[model samples]
Target chain A: MEKVIAGKPITVNEEGYLTDFNQWDEKVGEAIAAENHLSLTPRHWDVIKYLQNEQKNQVALSIRRVGKSGVVDIKELYSLFPNAPLKTATKIAGIPKPASCI
Target chain B: MKNLVILGAGTAGTMMANHLHHHLKTPEWNISIIDERDKHYYQPGFLFLPFDIYTPDDIIKTVEEFIPKEVSLIKSKIDKIVPEENKVQLTDGKQLDYDVLIIATGAKIATEETPGMEGEEWQKSVFDFYTFDGALALRNKLRDWTGGKLVVHITEMPIKCPVAPLEFAFLADSFFKNKNMRDKVEITYVTPLSGAFTKPKATEALTHLLDEKNIRIESDFAIEQVDNEKKEIIDYGGRAIPFDILVTVPTNKGDELIERSGMGDDLNYVPTNKATLQSKVYPNIFVLGDASDIPASKAGSVAHFEAEILTDNILHFVKGEPLTEAFDGHANCFIETGNDKALLIDFNYTHEPVEGSFPFPGIGPLRLLKESRMNHMGKLAFRWIYWNVLLKGTHIPFVSANMSDSGKHYEKALNE
Candidate 1:
């Protein structure tokens, strides 16, 4: 189904993850973060940018990798998005859901 | 010349197929394994599902991919087992005659057994992580759910992966803390046991971890029913604990077919000689995995260890030789403690988890009953090993099926 985020039709899978990466922007990220009851901080954006860059390179993201990424450590990443750091972070970053995530 | 039929193509059944195929000569022994489903699940991955550490594809694979090509893979639901006649009846009215039978049909979460557990609040407010569907549903639920009272509970003991509830509590603490809602979410670790775990030493260590995380421990809580309207879990003692969201490990019971076959105990688990893994009533039938009523944790590690012994015993039984090898109920598990750390516990029927180094004793590497980052790495690496090695019946080096006391700290307990 499609969700209208800031008047832009964004497609999502059955699990409510983004289907199209192109449809995501700062406004869409804000909307997604709001749904998860999170207000993305600068730290969260750093993790989001790291995830988006890694996704473009088709690299798998894990807690250990994120911790060593130089952008943000695992502890700080977890603090930024508590529910599920990699999952929630990727969702708001407008990347396709990581296959490693169930 | 003879037939060996194994029911349920799960962890034990799949391994047995690969192991026995190599051990038993083909054409002389017709080996067949049966199950209703085509997919095999990496059950331990269920714990990581709700946490989004593992995806659905990471945990599931086709059963045929694991079963040896030499072994006959029968895709059909079992109707009954006629032990006296050495025949198993299928749902399609097909009766398969066997010289020997192995029951590996594992246990499942019995949610309906608890009153009001599967009521209107099921999958809405209350959920289970024991099943693939339940795990996926919980993933969705936790995705948008804000901070509140999160209860990680177990309805009874002897459930599969007994430490998973504790792992969930630990991971939830880390998860909520990462979300910056640690204060908003009041986490509770509830169980039917008197302490945090079944074993005393492990319980002491685990309870301390629970304390450190500010997760309340509600021990010895035997839930009578779930009052979904009020979102309260009422115990047998009339104590009620309210929760905004409940993640439960429901009562675990063997396949219903075991009940219908009249070959199982009260919980539908087969009554087998604990050491031999052979059925007490019928000599030709053997039991392994969660299907057997053994005093071992129903984890994949136990099944892997049992499979090694049962394979040797089956060959002895076929040759009319005495079954010599005994299964010591060795169970090895890595408990995820959150924050990129986990604890490794290795114990058996005769030994309790102690503080020491594993494999090499005091030399180094994985620590027993102690939390460490290496242990967490081991936990993550196990998923790869499970898929590539364990199911293929390959022996993991240095790790024997029996518990080793070498290099372990046993002074205090042994002196007593």
Candidate 2:
């Protein structure tokens, strides 16, 4: 599945994210980002420090072979959106406040 | 209790917030949206603004209006993300912790990346349509300006809306014509691409429109510098393209936040699983929208698709289940070809843009890789759809997250 570049059939409900990873343009980014050198620009480093300094328990993932994905966060999501489903779905089975994501 | 903290309240973040806020358990699960700005600009409408297709009020909206009210909103600048700590530090000295952090933080315009782009002529003879002020300013210049050499240039590859430059050229031709200056203005399109676009077939189709509109094109012209004083744009080859009005698509870079995190690419984009929207450096951190390094157009539709898949996978991660969703790099865009018609192209990672029908196959209300009035209306109507359906995180009835092949002439993947 990782190697496959096939576009799968999809039917999104009323609300969803903008682009699917399968259809997003990360490779295009690699082709482009590879052309840009950050020898003088220390912006990437700033991101690493800023993102890490904020999180208390970031769950680390592997880096892409070329390192060109769009967003990078390093924290366990549990602490971030504490009110999300997998955390309390069983315990709070019947509340109707709708504070978090569906 | 679990928390889902989504960073950046742009198109991707907003949609994910709405989706999860509606689906995730309440009280026990909290969904918070964090962003730096208070106003939301209908980005796609930026393209139309310079051409007078949309008014300022039409494109501007309060960010709070589009964000789901149920989701707690944090109007603060992110100081840094301490992945090791699973928390985010705000500029205000406050702290927000998350259980599952979704980084939908999008891309940024790196105007300085190009050697001469940031020089004197910036916002003068030189301009960018990527921002609201830039677009609005260009509109005023286009309205009263007498015809001369109008150069629509692309500083490099991987900029958002690959077809936008061509659309700008096409629409400019129409704009001048409406202003009774078409015969007076000499239009030229300069790009770093080997041709009109990355895709060969679409390039051939779009290149024809350029020719038909008498729009001169300079391909393979890598930018060297912007000689703002001389009002000239020089290519790496030492060739210079002089212009009276220069509408340039400057360098596009990932957010500075990516650089702060130190987990991004040379251009400051994060490294992630191309298909999973999962962070390449952090499993719990997922990515979507213009932020990813995926090889596709950085268009609104692409973000729309990825956010859906990322939302589902985030759910799977919470359950300790393997993510089943796979993104195929599907992106679709409507290229305004002037004369009240536009071209539609739909493709994924492996497939190139091919001629076909969309939404409805044989009876497509919208054609693919072909120019038509319907597509033009579709492009115009997108502004309305973006504000009402897209930003609200509400789904369009027929459009799916994945690219449909029913009507497309799915040639064997060329760039595969």
Measured by DockQ, the strongest candidate is 2
User: How close is every model to the real structure, measured as TM-score?
Assistant: 0.80, 0.79
Quote the positional error of residue B225 for candidate 1 in Å: 0.5
Clashing pairs in 1: A78-B178, A82-B178, A82-B179, A101-B55, A102-B54, A102-B55
Single out the weakest 10-residue window by summed lDDT for candidate 2 chain A.
A93-102
In angstroms and one decimal each, the interface RMSD of every candidate reads 14.2, 18.7
Tens digits of lDDT, candidate 2, A82-101: 22211121111111111110
Q: lDDT, candidate 1, residue B6? A: 95
Using TM-score as the measure, which candidate wins?
Answer: 1
**Model 2: residue B398 alpha-carbon error in angstroms:** 2.0
